[model samples]
Target: MSPPTRRSPRSRPSPEAAEPNGTFDAATRQQIDAVVAALHELYPDADCELAWETPLDLLIATILSAQSTDARVNQVTRDLFSRYRTASDYADADVAELEEEIRSTGFYRQKAKNLIGAGEILRDRFAGEVPRTIDELTEVPGAARKTANVVLGTAYGIPSGFVVDTHVKRLAHRLGLSAETRPEKIESDLMARIPRDEWIFAAHALIWHGRRVCHARRPQCGDCGLADHCPRNGL
Candidate 1:
């Protein structure tokens, strides 16, 4: 036993690495409520920024938004949507042409492939309509839990689960609302803490706050509305 093998600094668990137990006491619940109130006040009009007129439009836009900004996705979809109005249109699209259409979205090849696959599934399995349930939506290509949640909540007004995007993930940790690293686990913590009715609104509000104030690289803590309640965890 060579002097009790010392653990390296890098190997040590981060201060922010505590895992949420998916349950909260009264005090914690109150804090969560306060945070929700703050968010409501901060972003009263918080909603999905992606431009879409139909469930299929939203489903495609959300899928296109992966690793891309909403603004960019919106721009691309403006033209793409006009060209491909239905699932059958996408299912029949040429992969190379589709790739070129969404080339600026980054990972165009894969995105195009997923879009085609999703379109085919929606056309064949779902009768050319976006599925309402998370399980069904996740069956489409490019629609993982996050994307499925977005489609379900925003498109169908069903709070299947919280949409744990990068912004939500960052805000969850910084606000000390969750201590989990994985999005699914973090979503579980959030669902446990936030009210069922407020699930959809909370996800949108957190996203807006994260984009406007709690930025990833340089959070404007001074301008943050939740500054008082925020423990500034892992800052």
Candidate 2:
């Protein structure tokens, strides 16, 4: 898809568009539509950056991604996946050995514990299969709403909710798409404004945009195609 035409500076939202009161009025919703459209144009193929071939791989990678980058998680999983091929493999893994394998991802002890617990849950509850629904997925030790959303949308094509990672959270605030502080609240705001069909794509696009352009610090507003639609909140 071609990028959206850059809006003239004069057409940009006024300072009042920041909407400090946090209301999703007509104008705010319209701006959201524009932002979503621009995101589509900018990242038509955006997807979960984590490398995974199976639902179980994605689930484990998402857990490892907590407090770590996708690149790092992928590096660890390359060797880890080869050794632990199934839920039972992880369930039977030695905690110390697993921790050493994923040590580079940080918080290795807890992450290893969570992974083992997740494996046990998957093996016992789901018959060695990853759960499809959010509730069941989240029941796994490390799969929260964000992780579950990633697994559901990316693996099963289920639009359960928006994946509110740090990048999505930052971009949502900067683009004036959500004024909420908490991840769940931010996700709720985005889900309300963004169409269900576009939920998965929108989250991926926002994450890509956040990483590529709209950084948490030193956001490249000048090069942003959505700058006109964005209110430049907290810039």
Candidate 3:
């Protein structure tokens, strides 16, 4: 018998392809489409806020962004990226020194550890290059699906899945698009309702709305264009 062949890293299937079909009714589908359209009009240039020059930079910045803001992560990475230019640099870095370097980001010990371990994996397994697929990218120590999606979609222009950060999760529920709280479940709900091409932009636009308008403590309903269509669930 022939051994089962592994799929090429570049050919990783989009989340939209694997999601269950017909999750949205005709009315609901129209509502979601309208919501997405409004968001596009409001934030036509929405994109990843984290600054990165390469996939490795994005991966590292994303890992550091856990429980932290993108502004904070970028502040830390300005010095961090300049010091460690490549995955190999991180792989060979002193853990103690690295921890101190990223201390301001909070959870420095774990973040530094993940950075080193991920670097080692990249150097050993993927020839010191960032993997293009969600499956392969998630193999790095700090990268879960959220981080992988950020790197793949933002860095490589591959729409692997919708990025479900805190903003996405909160906005999804508030807009009545997703009843779930967990990021993964919320992402699934969104993928089922939103079109394939809009996945990446949708995440960025939602994130921008959450940050600029639909704030956690005080969502500016009057300032929001979606206020009319939104069910305002849990708000």
Residue 181 CA error for candidate 1 (Å)? Answer: 0.3
- TM-score comparison, 2 vs 3, better candidate: 3
What tens-digit string does per-residue lDDT give for candidate 3 at 42-78?
9988888887777788889989999888888888888
Off by over 4 Å in 3: 1-23
RMSD (Å) per prediction? 12.9, 9.5, 8.0
lDDT score of model 3?
0.83
Tell how far residue 119 is off in model 1, in angstroms.
Answer: 1.0
lDDT values for all models: 0.83, 0.82, 0.83
lDDT of 2 by residue, 85-186 (tens): 899999999999999999999999999999999999999999999988877887889888889889989988998788999999988887777789988788
True-structure lDDT of candidate 1: 0.83
Cα lDDT of model 1 by residue, 101-199, tens digit: 999999999999999999999999999999887768888999888888887888788977788999999999988878999887888778777777788
| TM-score for each of the candidates | 0.89, 0.88, 0.89
What lDDT is obtained when candidate 2 is compared to the true structure?
0.82
Instruction: Provide the clashing-pair count of each candidate structure.
Output: 0, 0, 0
